[model samples]
Target: MQTHELIKALAADSRRTGVAMNTVWWGAVLVAIVVATTIFFALLGPRPDIAIAAQTVRFLFKFVVTIALAASAFALLRMLSRPETDPRGLLPYLVIAPALILTGVAIELIAAPAETWSSRLIGTNSLVCLTFIPLIGIGPLALLLLALRHGAPSHPALAGAIAGLAAGGIAATFYASHCTDDSPLFVATWYTIAITILALFGALGGRVAARW
Candidate 1:
């Protein structure tokens, strides 16, 4: 076959089959959770704060899990009605969320008051806020990369939502380890905000990157 024909054939394959990016993405999440949970338990076994931490962890965990579930439902809809949609393109952002969260934390810390800095640097509330740093950047960056590679997904909104939720879920797992708020209320309010910011970035990324 000619070069142009070969290129066309590859594109046709990509459009025909998303190739189960969700399986790979969700597998990464499950493995991360299992490994992180086992390590945390082994290293920090039965601490007095375990009960309190579990309470808070439950809320955050549920939130993250819910996003994945919701995305799955949406994916089913897209697959049935929008066969051209390529959800797999969202996978790259899984690797981008942590970096963005770290950047956000650094920016916030530098701008914080010195007196409050020490406490905030070592406090639960502060750590919770820090989680947002990468959450915002990851989705956008992933979308950008995927666009450069595959052009745009047939349905940008669906792709964006999948990317956003996947990133949010992974970041929450890390946040659970680093922060110690021990209150479902705190996770529901603060953690939700962080994920929301990231999701918004994902949407924006899809819009901007799709244009490229």
Candidate 2:
């Protein structure tokens, strides 16, 4: 309300500069895909029988969950990048993927016998799942954290975490193709853990990078 405060605010606004948020975000999306895909191929490409795998509902479901997560997190992170955006209204979107995964899990539990449940959850590549999702995601996470610095986010840490979620989703989508484990149980457990790791890293990175 004061003249000095008004001048200071105007000065701050003037100092903010660069590409439009849309341009920056879309650019980040493309770059992230490149970065994640590069890592995926270098580490592990799609499974050998992906053509056959494509026929299964469970195999296809992995993409549905991962893409949903990426889309939701991307939308929220974009909102969080702006100081004026509330982000709360969009919070529900984040749960959609998780809920879908849970539903898949429930369906899996019902369809499969109890004896096989443990094997389904454990999977053949639990270690690989843990290792590569984070590995592939780290680059995109860093990219997003850096991108967040371009905007005046009120919740830098949260924004960074969402960036990680987006990165995780992207990584998982690629990883899912190569993964032999198609059970929802495996995805719900291992995939969630892998993504959470990236989210944690993103939070720390956000705290440091997005700080004003």
Candidate 3:
């Protein structure tokens, strides 16, 4: 082949790789969201008093936490999907959601009475939260793992773990609207547990499926 032709072919491959990765990533996210949203509404929905609930700071704050987590995880997963990118630069973002939840927990403890702490942490929907978040997040996690398969992730386990986080965030965002529990204590405890299950699954899935 001619020298110029070889250079052009290489450039074309590079562009195609970038575009293909982006397309699959975005498509995975969209399909995941649709699957999650459909499952959430089919089985559960925004609480009856969501309008009144929306007026409260505590209720509003949980969405902020979930959105932050999802957004940060999505960004990190993108970096992890690319073999050439150093994902460490985005590692700090993973801390943001936890930090926000912790801050909320601190505020709640100081502002609310001590006697209510256990109840808030335990909450009324402990069983429901545990059951549904993982249930909803599973679909998203699978979709994300498929995307990782399409891309070349240097560390499939790590990439899969981040995929879990992203799926959990998306699942939690929808679940929060349905949950009546507004305390940060409940969120920090139950939401974390639910999301952790999905992350663990993602890690396992990655190790099994994302290799090569």
Candidate 4:
């Protein structure tokens, strides 16, 4: 092939690849939000007390943590998309949400009665948390996996894990609205378990489906 023709072809291919990646990233975000919102409304809408300012803030706090985690994980997933990219730079961002939550847990422990610690930690909705989080997360996770495939990540499992974190975060945000348990103890325990379960599933799924 002529030199000019070869260069043109490479440029075209690069542009196409860039467009594809953008499509996947934005598409995944839109689909995740729409599907999660639909499920939330169809299944368990916001708690009845959501209108109250204090209750709203309480729920909003959890939403912030989960959504922040999701955003950070999404950023990490984008970084992992390139085969030669290193993920270490993005790791600290991923921990911000959890660290904030841990701080909240410490404060709650200091302020709340020791006698109520177990009850708050256990919460009334542990089983419900386990069920709804993973259930709602499945759609978003699947969408994220589909989107990640376009990037051709080197470590499929890691990419998948991050995608799962994003999905789980989105799902947990929705779940927080329905959850009556507002204590940071409850979030530290049950919410963590639910998100971990989704991450595990994402890891396993990525192992099988995220390969180049």
TM-score of each: 0.46, 0.91, 0.92, 0.89
RMSD of 1: 11.0
Query: Tens digits of per-residue lDDT for model 2 on 88-139?
Result: 7777979989999999999999999999999999999999999999999998
Leading candidate by lDDT: 3
By lDDT: ranked, best first: 3, 2, 4, 1
Candidate 3, 37: how far from true, in Å?
0.7
Q: In angstroms, how far off is 159's CA in candidate 4?
A: 0.8
By TM-score, how accurate is candidate 4?
A: 0.89
By TM-score, how accurate is candidate 2?
A: 0.91
Off by over 4 Å in 2: 1-19
lDDT of 4: 0.84
**What's the lDDT of the predicted structure labeled candidate 1?**
0.47
The residue-by-residue lDDT of candidate 4 on 75-131, one tens digit each, is 888777666556777779788888989988998899999999999999899999999
- Backbone clashes, each candidate: 4, 0, 0, 0
Task: Write the number of the candidate with greater TM-score, choosing between 1 and 2.
Answer: 2
lDDT of each: 0.47, 0.89, 0.91, 0.84
Model 2: lDDT of residue 210: 86
Better of 1 and 2 by lDDT: 2
- What does candidate 3's lDDT look like per residue over 1-212, in tens digits? 97556545644554578887889989999999999999999999999999999999999999999999998999899878765556677769889999999999999999999999999999999999999999999999999999888866667998899999999999999999999999999999999999999999999998876886
